[model samples]
Target: MPASQYADMFCVEVWPENAPAWNLFEALQTQWRAGSGGVIGLDYGVLAEELRVREIPPADHEQLRADVRVMEAAALQEIYAETEK
Candidate 1:
């Protein structure tokens, strides 16, 4: 299956090296669970914040953001195709 199809099925955690970032995702997931709606999207803003808090290098942050954008675009395209089917 495509990454977009399972994007919301599970959250990715780049652990050990980025444990704090993973923890941030866990916290956000907890807050999301309290709401009525299921997790259908990601909060990149919060992720960026967490990365900053974790003192991730700027170069690494840019690379991570770029990777995420690629995945998000692919996921959106997949969803659009599904809707058109």
Candidate 2:
């Protein structure tokens, strides 16, 4: 799948305004793509804590959590389809 599709799975909004947090998220994405476990290690709690430390607004943080759920569901579905095949 295209990289944009991966991004779409997680985030519908533009990049976060906080540069450091955005950078961290990008690094995490790199790790995510390299790993076989899909979203296994990419827990929402970790992400939310990082964003909280960066002082991201609560509303935006909640949106990120929702986005992660969307992404995790898509990843799980893809894994299931692949295994079935």
Candidate 3:
């Protein structure tokens, strides 16, 4: 089943390798126990903040951002197609 079917709210965490981001997020959302998968969207604002916090070098950040944009565009296209259907 989709996560949205189980949980009313979602907390997406993007963090460094050392950080227990998922565990921490799950702890906060203890009311609704949901497993992760079938993500239809990317929170780019949160992504940017994570990249900044991780101190990703400007050059690498640009490259990563470009890659993420491509992914976000594809996800949007798929979502639009589903809606059109």
Candidate 4:
């Protein structure tokens, strides 16, 4: 199909300016977490939905959570030290 013809025949639906992508994603993530087992990461879920338009499985769920916890602890410590200064 020619570019111009394709555009005219199938108008690409655009998200209203009011529904910013980030806001939509946050809403969906909230819903998924509330309903699902909270077994998947938000980034992976969003990327799969928007890009692949399919479900995504958690990648190394245990490892990811562990790494996040370590990072979180370090961040908290840094903040605590900074505040004392």
Regarding TM-score, does 2 or 4 come out ahead?
2
Candidate 4 TM-score to native: 0.34
| Superposition error at 84 for model 1 (Å) | 0.7
Q: Candidate 2 residues 11-85, lDDT tens each? A: 645445544444445544633432564444455556766676777687676655656556556766786688779
lDDT of 2: 0.59
lDDT of each: 0.59, 0.59, 0.53, 0.44
Error of 3 at 73 (Å): 0.5
Q: Which stretches of model 1 miss by more than 4 angstroms?
A: 1-42
Residue-pair clash count for candidate 1: 0
**For every candidate, C-alpha RMSD to the true structure in Å:** 8.4, 7.1, 10.7, 15.9
Q: Give the Å error, residue 82, model 4.
A: 0.5
Q: What is the lDDT of residue 46 in candidate 2?
A: 60
Q: 6-56 in candidate 1: lDDT tens per residue?
A: 887876657585554345555444322113433355677677776788787
Provide the lDDT at 3 for model 3: 85
TM for every model, in the order presented, reads 0.45, 0.47, 0.47, 0.34
Between the candidate structures 2 and 3, which one is better when assessed by lDDT? 2
Q: By summed lDDT, which 10 consecutive residues of candidate 1 come out lowest?
A: 30-39
- Per-model tally of clashing residue pairs: 0, 0, 0, 0
lDDT of 4 by residue, 1-85 (tens): 7898887985555557423343334344443222243222334454345433422235534443344444445645665577679
Worst 10-residue stretch by lDDT in candidate 2? 30-39
Error of 2 at 52 (Å): 1.9
